[model samples]
Target: MAFSTIKDSITFHPLGDAAIVIQAGADIREEIHERVKQLFTCIEQHPFDGFVEAVQAFTNVTVFYEPYTVHQAAHLQTHNLSPYEWVKGYIEGLLEEKWQGGGQVKRRIVDIPVCYGGALGPDLEEVARINGLTSEEVVRIHTKGTYLVYMIGFAPGFPFLGGLTEKIAAPRRETPRMSIPKGSVGIAGKQTGVYPISTPGGWQLIGQTPLPLFRPNENVPSLLRAGDEVRFVQMSEKEFFSMKEAER
Candidate 1:
């Protein structure tokens, strides 16, 4: 949805006993996404008494909290509303306080080297054929496009990327594979992503990247996060293996 709609359009609903979801707007537009980031950051900056964590998605922020503590918080005594109402009001206040265009959401540009076609991208030819283009042209278009990390879900560190070129878009495989190797890039519908770990999936295979997407031991476990910009670059198989060895 547009920025003007944000004033009275936000919907605050409870996600269960201990969580609340604040929906800013609709659609997958950058404006709504940036507002999501802005609201996420606002909550992070001034965490309430029982606030546990907040998960930011394309258009909403799910806030987890300790219900007991939140209900008993001395600061919330002024509001006679229930815990859900109290939290909603608090977030609404924050929106009014800090929602001044939100500015440009800070984003990190991550470069991903992908070895496309051949065994790595078995569906590359099919995807190209569906779009009436050669595999080389498909790779060129995919590499030229800039993607946004809308959210990380499905698997640990598996980024749900936006901004894939519509030219090479294809449907998911009718039958999903039991084991898709980690770093395998795929496209389904208008979205694209990489498999952070071996798992069952049906997105049409496009390429593979050797970079580790998740590192639990590190301070930031996921290589990419929501709002980050991703640019995929084509690489030769020889360079891909060489870089893999260098990383190891």
Candidate 2:
């Protein structure tokens, strides 16, 4: 594996046609999340010729690009270069220059409203019972903690969040739910995530947000982006219904 540091971030050279993984840290942490966000922003603002898209994951950002376009570009074609090598070199050079001057990118924190422990949150009681905490206590801890958007995966626009309080951590259900409704808030092991679409899942359901997670018709399909901060604000069932109706 080839590794190089750019600014405070690190890039990894892995074999892949569609993308190369640029890792910011060895493990998942808030700082790493911020760094990854910064790098993503940097690339987006000053994208290379063939850049297509980026996939943000736990500790890395995978950059996807068109190899043919990159290979044929005037600035990149001089050397008989492999697509992977050319892209890697270009990113490394860009990072070294970008970080020479001192400045940091700021990430935004988003708050989502959730209604817990009712018909909306059918599994909330189960989760609370498993953790030996009262239903109210579980909601308190979940809301009190600040979560980081580590990645957007599992399904389109589905945000895999980190930094759940251990007081509410629980394993996935023995049998996965046949179909989980969209916007379902769930916890599995130490990770917490929101389901972006109606799909089958095994995560312990606790609550759900009325907001739409993925809307393909909009300019940005996903409501949440990687490297963003998320906080779940508790709402009453009435409030949830109000918000849902407002969206209609």
> Could you list the CA RMSD of all candidates, in the order they appear?
2.2, 3.2
Task: Give per-residue lDDT, candidate 1, residue 168.
Answer: 85
- lDDT per residue as tens, model 2, 22-70: 8888878876776677667667777887889876777777899888888
Candidate 1 wrong stretches, greater than 4 Å: 1-5, 75-80
* Residue pairs in collision within model 1: none
Give, for candidate 2, the lowest lDDT window spanning 10 residues.
1-10
Worst 10 residues of 1 by lDDT: 1-10
Q: Specify the highest-lDDT model's number.
A: 1
TM-score of 2: 0.89
TM-scores of the models, in the order given: 0.93, 0.89
Q: Which stretches in model 2 have alpha-carbon errors above 4 Å?
A: 1-9, 74-78, 100-105
